[model samples]
Target chain A: MLSETQEERKMAEGEEVKNKQVLFRNYIDGFPKESDMYISTENTIRLKLPQGSNGVLVKNLVLSCDPFMRLLMQKNDDSGLFGCYTPDSPITGYGVAKILDSGNPKFQKGDLVWGMTGFEEYSIITETESLYKIEHTDVPLSYYTGILGMPGITACAGFYEVSTPKKGETVFVSAASGAVGQLVGQLAKLMGCYVVGSAGSKEKVDLLKNKFGFDDAFNYKEEHDLTAALKRYFPEGIDIYFENVGGKMLDAAILNMRIHGRIAVCGLISQYNLAEPEGVKNLMPLIYKRITMKGFSAFDYLAHYSKFYDILLPLIREGKIVYIEDVAEGLEKTPAALVGLFSGRNIGKQVVVVSRE
Target chain B: MLSETQEERKMAEGEEVKNKQVLFRNYIDGFPKESDMYISTENTIRLKLPQGSNGVLVKNLVLSCDPFMRLLMQKNDDSGLFGCYTPDSPITGYGVAKILDSGNPKFQKGDLVWGMTGFEEYSIITETESLYKIEHTDVPLSYYTGILGMPGITACAGFYEVSTPKKGETVFVSAASGAVGQLVGQLAKLMGCYVVGSAGSKEKVDLLKNKFGFDDAFNYKEEHDLTAALKRYFPEGIDIYFENVGGKMLDAAILNMRIHGRIAVCGLISQYNLAEPEGVKNLMPLIYKRITMKGFSAFDYLAHYSKFYDILLPLIREGKIVYIEDVAEGLEKTPAALVGLFSGRNIGKQVVVVSRE
Candidate 1:
């Protein structure tokens, strides 16, 4: 072992600062609660990267609270869609991080990147492939956690690639005011398609119609008969259904879908929390209408990020596209912010800020 | 009115020969039976074609017994996948017919064709576009009702167009010995795929493995745990699933589907007779696995018949593909043959031989 110099000794001591983290407890049963995860200050950080490693040490700035995280909390994971979080470990998801030290040639010290990371002050990302370097910063850096992140690409892929929408087509989005749905509704509007959105609250519904520019919007909670509500909104039948919430809503959407309709499955927020998810009884419509239902992940479409930005960046700069985010102030509020997602408390994309700089 | 000449009277008397017909009594309940349809020799036919008509008078030779016919017996008919049989009128489906007279330019008298027609001895086909002219007479005319007709094209479209299979890929076909399933298994084998099939009986299973050249075959009815059966066959997970039998089998198929798997929804024979269809519970895997479930109709792909024939005809001539037909002699047995499909009684592509001439 080489002897440490005086400057190295100072650097080593500075690295011993406390690293606060939100640690996931044992696997959840029914709905996840804030108590399912607790804030932990026991773990400390070593800021320097180990030599000859392909890992990069990042200081996490903003963390996203997504519904898919609930799916990861399940004890028995058969889907194996997103990997599960380990017990007594910091929960990982999409976040904006600043590179502290790098061993990989693709990244450098202090580069702003938004991708996958743990919900902690600092994370060692051995898999540099998950991280995409942030280029344009004129928009808020926290936007990387929501609109410019997974939700953005998800909506784009679903609307353009999966739905295969033609101009003047009718588009319906479930969970219309959520991070992905909001963007999907907007994308449909830009394509000159008649767009309708369904949300949980009146406020969210209003946001969908007014802010997101949906042709019409409704609060799904107020409607006693979902199929009737869908029929009333889409009298001609839905051509493209962006399925974010599954179960009865999905059945209703299938019933109202026109011949040769398309359904893009991005997330199932409603079913993720249930011990036993509801069975879709009206799938016979799939055959009758010749509908195509496809499920896709954003990571698969990341290769076309430059193409996505070519369309999205111009929309953002000109205010043609709008994004709504419900942000929690501090890292300590991460658990509550995430737990609130199930109860429909968050108005839009939920994000937790660890640090401003 | 013009006076009837002796020659015109003789021609009209000749056309008055017994027009044997199967008339639908009413919309069905539970299951369809022979009593639901009664043979009527009462309806008379007109021998001379109407002037300025785009119709063709056909002598129905053979009729197809399909599972989709059962769905047409439903009372509500909300799906509208197939048109319902009108009360006191004959049910229409794919059949082999001899054109005795034609007013359409595309069809001529004595032109042997196979297409959609009524379940009667003599019928007028005003919609001649649905008909396909038979080119090859080397094959039996009865083959038009099975191997060369709707079922053949259905299997082709489902396997090639929908499954989008690659050579050496794994394919699992449910209802393996049925009309479409048998052809799908053979097509998969011809593509050099690892083909596995599931049937209801040991006899059908033997046919699938021994005769159809499937890599492996299992009786789904014998297996208590379908997911376990699938896991045993495809340890790595299934790449493509030709979904013929929906319900429990579809649920299991979804559970065993690999990343980016495709499911071609051809028929849901299991759910057709049930008043309330079974609910699919494992749809959550769709989002995680990123699976694509596409439901298509063979009629929509009729334009590609020559393309299907380009591949299918060569296979038939080379003895690379073989088709099995279960013929129920006489039009009197048509009702029993169609109902037999629901109970898994028919051995292969069920056909009702109306007239050998």
Candidate 2:
């Protein structure tokens, strides 16, 4: 299979091939647009790793479009967590790839792996520490970009570890049709919780109630008063809140929170594209209701990936859980797919298919 | 002593006597003013418990002027935690009292106690569940209002349990000279943490540094930019933040918090007077830093009062802990003293001395 691709390009073992990539133009201020990045076919990469360089040369197959990528597009000053994207360079993110050649003993040629990689056809991943070998071929390889990957671990950790959910509790999740929210709502239902969700469109709301099995769902865009909308759904008050969208959604959730409720803040998608994020004013409820609002990420719980896999894999195989993805066909659609996240353009998890192999 | 007081007023054990009280005129909107409550001497009460009623009649001594009392002045709709003040009624609060007559076996005549009572010369405490007998009198009686009462338990629970402080970590306390903040700062220092505090005035700052044994102190009022001011103090970032004053101070502290930092939301005195509390704008750091912000109260930890008393009592007896009180003489001054809290008028723990007896 490796020789066939090399022969198609008319290249030898150590020969160079044209590497098409999407390069970030510069640091952006507000919402990202397709113009912020440019597609380039001017770069070339050797199929083999250089001698004494312990790196894996991989052929990029699938790329993920996540909300956190927007933060990387900004010039970070003090937040040392994310490595900001450099201008005129291929943007790096979580992706699935096939190793073509390797100087590292951990990965061999033709091995499939998923983790951090460049958004290019073929490249050398110097920091192979972030990559994990794919052993389960029974699942779709693109599942590594959503359910079996970052978003999967995020839902497990946020619901179980951060939210501290219990059976029969009332729960509310915002951005119900998104990658993490969909999984969380389903997981809450499995725990026997009375779950309600809010999304942007009617289609997403239908998917949440009928597809994800949320007890009830609402279209937040149609509701002028979010606090009233939440109160209408949760007449008794919410016991746990899976906070995906910040701004007014967060403020309203606080008001409707039960005594000693927990809010697992996984993302603030509503504020990511704004020049200045909206301020949350109803925090006084935290004191009055004795609420706990904690912030966490999948990276923080990566060590428990095996535990997450054990819990979710069975549910997936038994038909107890389902996943949805909106896959863009080619790498050229990467920029638009990523930008679409801010405008609620995608129906579910957004992924860009770079190559089938 | 009870007989002497009854004889001085020319009243028998079952006779009526003039009861001067400060009555709440109406529910307030913003900051409470002295005019919001009026001193009335027309009320009279029988100096004895009612037949078949398990209640205690007591003479009020020292009353606590706490920030939470401001919250009760508002019209409460859903916050069932606090019982709101009724129009044309004696304002209720924490106070030290001497029992004159008792219908319950738990409390006897001439026993000194501290708990919830009316802000008047005399009060019939129907709920004996909230009161605790004063067994140890070696410390000043006024200490019960500041260091040995609700505020004392608040500091102990917030610092040790909620914040989860580790030795040699960094701690920042806002409103450092107040009842709870003062004790929290000292407790953090005793645990070997590098402690810094922010207060409203230079005098309070001096007390925090020199008297309360805080490692560093600053006057937050003098600084135009609170975020820069916090960064100057906590260059390495803060591990634990004892949040007493909310609004801009909370925003500044969020920006300066270390990874996995804990914020104990004890009070929000700064926002008590505002019609609309300020919205915190820098909460994104909670996600980047993976911070935990929890809200708690002394009432939640009342079951652990023995544990708190065991720890704080020894520190007070050995002079390892020092308490400062801004005692306003006479019951008529209760309204003025409480109103002073919003303006940063009183230093240390504000207390009203109803009677020295």
Candidate 3:
């Protein structure tokens, strides 16, 4: 057994020398076109940790293709608030990885970890704080990239802390099957609130209603009048609106919001690619209804990660919560998988598989 | 004095027979064209309190002409949440009044109060609990109609409590010379914040800077690029936005907000009149910036009313905070005064004086 383990380590080191990488050729202009990225493999990945460093070397397993990554690739003046990603650099994103070697004591050899990993098969992480150790091997490791990772915490913190949902209150969620929205809908239902969600495709809409236990779901793309559709689904008007698609949907949601309603703004995927965003026409409803619309990032709620894990892990074990992953194989498919998110092609949480464990 | 008191009581009884009042002609379709209402002096007002009711009879001294009243005039199929004023009925609003008679223990005969009163000389109030006694007599009685009134508490609660200011942060106020905006700007200044204000007119802009002590003031009507103007004023980006004017101003403010910014939605004056209110075009900024925008009514914060008085009265006495009022002479001018709020015709708070002390 000892001889076999030594041989397996040597074979893994040999494979690490050959780096299979997906590179972002240039920064996206308006909407990310399919032709922007070309996948290519590189040789000579450094297996040993770099000398005099706080960095850890890891083999990437799963990578998340999120809407926020598109914002990072856009060429613009660094709005000075949040730092923008520079061109020609390897696209860095949240991923599940296995640590091959570590110079820091916080992590060790052969440890399974998940965090800000690269799109390539191997990455050199300078900030060890970014990576979180994977505990509990009972569930699928890929779950860390979507359901148990950023999206889960986002829905938990925004809905519970910001919206402060009351039992039997009406909730409206946009992009209902996408990562954050799916969890938000399910969480609202769990909290004893009536949930309604909107998606672009029929499959996603059906998934919301049947699979996720949402009270109602609508295909916003096919609906002629969004406000009427929202009013229909939420007869009493929405008490909480988990906003994912901004623009016209936001305007319509404003009209349908109940008095003293709370709108937890998660993401606005609709206007990400446009040179100029669409306007929200019914903002006065906010005044008459006395609504509270707040926008927050998942990073701000890291303090609640342990708390989120405590609640969600049990739900997952009991099969009370379901997360659908739109998985694409290989690093070469990463770009297309990511681009599909903007066009609403992905029916669920978009994820890319680098290798099968 | 005793003979005069009896004569005044007898006159009050005689005046009850002649109901001089303001009534909505019909539900308004768009921006209130002046012909929407007619003020008529009638015979016989409702003098007696309803049987088995905790109601009061009030002789209104000052009636506020707020922009929100215009929203009540527009016919919405829904109960219009918050109970819209029925068509062809007396327009009810916040005002300062003298209690002519009372069946509630909190109020007594000849006591002064400020509350939700009708747009008329005398009214029979059923929900007398919503009304509160005017404790401080040092300030002008008309102050209850504007500065020391709903708008005052609005600025205090929204800015101080909701925003929770930090020193040296950039604060922006919209409709800066209006009742709420004026106080918001001053309060921001007192918190050691860098404040900028946007008003409709050059005179109002001047008042914001010269009178209200805003660090900078701009006429949003004159500036073609509101987003650019916000970027210029809030170079570091706006940390707090007191949102009184919505539509384009809201869009611009959203775009210019700093990460973790707070926006207090006091009013949406811009969208109140439009058939379909102008949409906010750049709402996507909320997610990136992680802003908290909330809408609140002073009525909800009644628990803090006495504390509000303790804090604000001393500020007024020391001349640390100043107030502005635009008073109309008679109840007959109430319709035009309320309508004037939308057009920016009133300089500060628009109030109609029905009687003098």
Q: Chain A structural similarity (TM-score) per candidate? A: 0.95, 0.97, 0.94
lDDT for model 2 comes to: 0.90
Candidate 2, which segments miss by more than 4 Å at Cα?
A: A1-4, A7-12, B1-12
Ranking by lDDT: 2, 1, 3
Give the per-residue lDDT of model 2 (tens digit) for A73-107: 99998893776999999998999999878889999
Per-candidate TM equals 0.96, 0.97, 0.91
Docking class of 3: medium
Q: Please give, for residues A1-357, the per-residue lDDT of candidate 1 as tens digits.
A: 112353256346555546789999978877899999999988886778777878898888899998889878976557656778899999999999989789999999879998989998888899889899999999889888887898898888888888899999999999999989999999999999999999999899889988889999999999999999999999999999999999999988999999999999888888887778888878787887899999888868987877888889899999999999999988899999999989899999999998886
- What are the interface RMSDs of all the models? 1.4, 1.0, 2.1
- DockQ for all models: 0.66, 0.75, 0.58
For every candidate, the chain B TM-score is 0.94, 0.97, 0.94
Rank by DockQ, highest first. Answer: 2, 1, 3
Which lDDT value does model 1 have at B65? 88
- Per-residue lDDT of model 3, residues A28-78, tens digit only: 667887677666565456667767867888878899988888887776563
Candidate 1: lDDT of B83?
Answer: 73
| Local lDDT at A93 for model 2 | 92
lDDT over C-alpha atoms for residue A138 of model 2 = 83
lDDT of 2 at A104: 92
TM-score of chain A of 2: 0.97
